[model samples]
Target: MATNLDLQEQEQIDAVKAFWGQYGNLITWTVTLVLVAFAGWNGWNWWQRDQAAKASVMFDEMDQAVQAADADKAGRVFKDLKDRFGRTVYAQQAGLLAAKVQTDKGQADAAIASLTWVADEASDEDYRSLAHLRLAGLLLDKQDYDGALKQLDAVKSSEFAGLADDRRGDVLAAQGKPAEAVAAWKKGWDALSDKLDYRRIVEAKLTAAGAQPAASGAAQ
Candidate 1:
């Protein structure tokens, strides 16, 4: 009986070895691939965190420049942010901040460049809309009516659609098209939410354009 048990154990060991010999290479390669993919995923997450940490420092410098009203310093820091971490959220925020300082300093061209970059490259839809709206305003100031209209047409966020239409009305009015302006303002007023204070401003503009809104919460 003991001799039979020993032979059975030996046969079981041989079966396991035979099975491994047939599939061992495939199992090894599969495990290797899974480990490499996991390592790569971890590396990618670490790299993004490192980038955000570095970019945040640069963004702070740009913000300080904006608060100081120093266009030159803001421009320098923005250039660095673009060169190093343009895809980061901090870099996009810095672009908006720097553009504000540049616009306030009468550097319209610089502001345009910054806003255009943000409009084109920002991953956030709202940032792109804000950039497009601000760019349209700058073009309107320059009396580039066609360019202003083009920027307004690119606004992507539904949240800003009302503001874009309002700006469009401004552009149309500036082009001596009061009828079109009034139509645009009416569209804007209807798009805005009654709870928003900005909706009252749109309502006012609509009324001033000789197109009084049939419903307005401005009195409320």
Candidate 2:
């Protein structure tokens, strides 16, 4: 009985050895890769958090500059944010804020540069649309009718459809196309949500452009 048990144990040991020999490298590598990937994922998350925190500080500085109405300071801080934390949302926000201050300060070129960066590089589509809208307005102010139209064309977000139409009306009017302007203004007037007070402004624009206002129910 003892000899038989020993033979059975030896057979079991041999089976295990054979299996290990066949799959040892693959199993070892698989486990190593899983552990490495888990560690890398944790490290990546930590890095992102660290980056965001630093970017937040810079954003606050930019905000302060904007509030103070110091266009030069806002532009400088915005440049730093773009250089060091360009991938962060804070950087995108800074660009927009900096553009606003620059525009207010009559630094049209600086505003254009900042808006262009946000329009091109922002990860969020909403921000890109916002940037494009502002850029279109700036281009319109500069009398770059074609460039304004091009910028308006870049804004494809549904949320900005009314704004785009309104901007198009302005561009067309600037190009001496009053008939087209009136049509564009009507579209913008109709596209706006009834809940928005801004729709009244659009209605006024339509009236000014020689387009009769739509019926109240139809406008709503």
The deviation in Å at residue 85 for candidate 1 is: 1.5
What is the Cα-based lDDT of residue 35 in candidate 1?
100
In angstroms, the error of model 2 at 210 is: 1.8
Ten contiguous residues with the weakest lDDT in model 2 = 211-220
RMSD of 1: 2.6
The lDDT values for all models are 0.91, 0.91
Give TM per candidate.
0.86, 0.90
Q: How much is 155 displaced in model 2, in angstroms?
A: 1.2
lDDT of 1 by residue, 1-220 (tens): 9999999999999998999999989999999999999999999999999999999988889878977999999989998998899889988888888899999999999999999989999999999999999999999999999999999999989989989999999999999999999888888877877778887787788778777888643323
Residue 107, candidate 1: how far off, in angstroms?
0.7
Error of 1 at 23 (Å): 4.6
Q: What is the lDDT for 198 in model 1?
A: 86
